[model samples]
Target: MVEALTTTIQTASLILAGWCLVSTFRDRPMLVPHLVAVGVLWLLVIAQAVVSAVLMSGGEGPAQTLMFVSYLVFIVLIPPACAVWGFVERSRWGPAVIAFACLILPVMLVRLEQIWNPAGV
Candidate 1:
């Protein structure tokens, strides 16, 4: 669990959330550019997940290994799932759903970080 990568992911997700929220307020559907941004974000998450998985395989994993792996899987899945939902809906609510997902992503990443490196460890 790299702190820098975690911070970068959190920052990017928050920025995306704000952008999606703005689009939602403007009554815009999920456009190609928005989807591209989501795709980029998803790639970043995938990279992080891959790195974490490698580290875990190397025997450098979190204390609660099962929980951390589950969170990792969930985190990797969220963006594309919501992106598809947004693309399918074709309305302002589409971006709203993305915005909501983006907002949740950062919080989940933070929790993942905590699980990866507990306070006393």
Candidate 2:
């Protein structure tokens, strides 16, 4: 895992979590801006996944390949699912849900990095 990409992903997720928190504090439902932010973040995650996959293909990966791929699939899934859940709920808690997911993202990415390069850090 590239440190730069990991930092980028972590930063993006933090920003997204901040946005969600602000919306939740204001008692606002999930809005278009939130969805758009999630979409952009999702794209970044996909890029990260692709890059990591390519690197892993070249054998630059952890021994637990199945576990790493499962994490990949999980991280790829959260944003869209939360977006849908947020939209469906249409309440302050919707943004809270998004905030929760965004919070999970960075931690998950950090774990992914560790799993990818256990000795790097």
Candidate 3:
């Protein structure tokens, strides 16, 4: 995994979470802008996944390969799933759902990093 890319993704996720939380507090439903932001985030995540896959295929893989891959898959799926949920719900809670997902995303990415390169390895 690329450390810089991971950090970028984490930062982006946190920022998006904050934005969604504000939207939730403002009693706003998920809108096109929010969906677009998520779409951008999703693209970033996909880029990271592709890079990781390439590196792994080239034998620069993580020790816990299965776990890493599973996390990777889930991480990739998260944004879109939550986006759909938010879009369909049509309420302030829609942003809340996205906010929750965004918050969880960073933690999951951190775990993915740990799996990719355990400390002192």
- Number of the top candidate by lDDT? 3
Model 2 lDDT at residue 46: 91
TM-score for each model: 0.96, 0.95, 0.97
Clashes of each: 0, 0, 0
In model 3, which residue pairs have backbone atoms overlapping below 3 Å? none
Among the numbered candidates, top TM-score falls to 3
Q: How does candidate 2 fare on TM-score? A: 0.95
Each candidate: RMSD to true structure?
Answer: 1.2, 1.0, 1.1
lDDT at 109, model 1: 89
Residue 50 local lDDT, model 3: 100
Better of 1 and 2 by TM-score: 1
Name the TM-score of candidate 3. 0.97
Deviation in Å, model 3, residue 8 alpha carbon: 0.8
lDDT of 1: 0.92
Q: Write the per-residue lDDT of candidate 3 for residues 1-121, one digit (tens) a residue.
A: 8889988998999999999999999999999999999999999999999999999999997889999999999999999999999999999999998889999988998898888889734
RMSD of 1: 1.2
In candidate 2, which residue pairs clash? Answer: none
Ten-residue region with minimum lDDT total, candidate 1: 112-121
Descending-TM-score candidate ranking: 3, 1, 2
